[model samples]
Target: MLKGSAILEKATGKDGTQSNHSAGKLLMIIECLADKSEPVRLMDISKELKMNSSTVLRFLTALVDNGYAKQEPETARYSLTYKICTLGSKVSSHIGIKDVARPYMTELSMLFGEVVCLAVEQDREVIYIDIVQSSTKMLRSMQRIGHIAPLHCTAIGKLLLLNYTDEQLDHVIADKGLTKFTESTITTKEQLVEELQSIRWNGYAYDDEKCEIGARCIAFPLYDVEGKVIAGVSVTGPTARMSIKQIQLKLQPALQIIGRLRKELGYTG
Candidate 1:
């Protein structure tokens, strides 16, 4: 039985029996092990956390079972697994990409008086991670954050598609089957491949009412620290307000913003 302590007291319930103290104690154990230079023994964890040895063992067992911690069979010492490092890297990458791109998205929206969207490719589709509506009261778009759209129709989608190899693009089109949303939507693999080449040459892509009738979008790819296309940024609006000529004239500012964003993300090329 553990002696009286604030943690144990807080872990105990009104019924006077030991409650689920495992959660807090588990965290404490992890923190204790993290601060140490080497794998820690069970007794050391229990002593440092001021919890019962049995309770520490129970939590440690759960950690090991869940792949968050590992134990040396001969030494009976425990340490955190590489899974934590993997999770941390993923979280950092996601946050870093989004953080570097958000200001650029907002700047584009304000500069163009059109909706701006940030999206990343996942499983051959473009998933919207963020959206900033135009400042203009009557001209705002209704696209929601976290919405998903096909990668063959939208400007952002095509911008990302430019990164794909010929074989990879063929595979995606074969699997996803470039279903048309409008008359302008690329309905064949050949047409999409040709458009992708043009996008690479022009350094940007235009939706031009391809995804939805009367909607126009101009998008450019964003590179990561590794010079790989990690996401796309787009300025989107109704065609009546954002015609092809207007979008062409406004391309310089968008390019400058994307250049700044790429540099912030550590893209050298």
Candidate 2:
């Protein structure tokens, strides 16, 4: 377990001659603020980082000035802002899940001659981060990387919601009302609750021309090392080629590939 001071020293340089000492100290203060769930006092941060109160205040002032942190007017305590999470999300979108899942997406696309997508939940919607287009020349899915879809309509979106509690689900419905896109689209809480139950029992989700009239999809949950649903992978195609029967026939092979992917991701269940 490397301590924060050790990391700070390494980041600044072991030799005490580094010019980036201020940058390192700023980062240390940021980490100190992040480690706490509630707003932290100025003196507590100074004591924990072994720095003078004035020095910590200077760095904290800079952070607050830049919108990376906020100070409570009543409590006079500091805490990190959503800006930190914004920076982290930008970095993770570029190098994390998309990179690890692209090869598997390609495999699925090649195996099925259909579009494959990788998606994660953000702000109550599913965002497609990576896509492997099918080799088929006739028709291509309109979905593109970075496109967002509602959580109640698409197969991948429903799959990603497997872990949401009833209260959370209700909140989502209240925030983003289920807008119907097609005749089969679920438009009420009761319908969505029943659909989610079936998804849980079947270990997968299906979109039967729900999102778009001719488009259909089948999706499975992608798990992290802790057995949490981190994302979802789905195959989409035209209704002519991806009827319910066809989706059922392809289910086992898709599950096999996903099983291998889960193992690689260190998911035990």
CA lDDT, candidate 2, residue 90: 52
Best by TM-score: 2
Error of 2 at 149 (Å): 0.7
State in Å the error of residue 64, model 1: 17
Q: Write the per-residue lDDT of candidate 2 for residues 106-183, one digit (tens) a residue.
A: 888877789898888878899888888877634556578899999999998898778789999999999999999999
Candidate 1: TM-score?
0.67
Candidate 2 global TM-score: 0.72
lDDT (tens digit, per residue) of candidate 1 on 34-118? 8888899999888888888987877677667667789999999999988768668756776687877888888998888988888
Worst 10 residues of 1 by lDDT: 10-19
Model 1 stretches astray by more than 4 angstroms: 1-91, 138-142
Candidates' lDDT values, in order? 0.79, 0.82
Task: Give per-candidate clash totals.
Answer: 0, 0
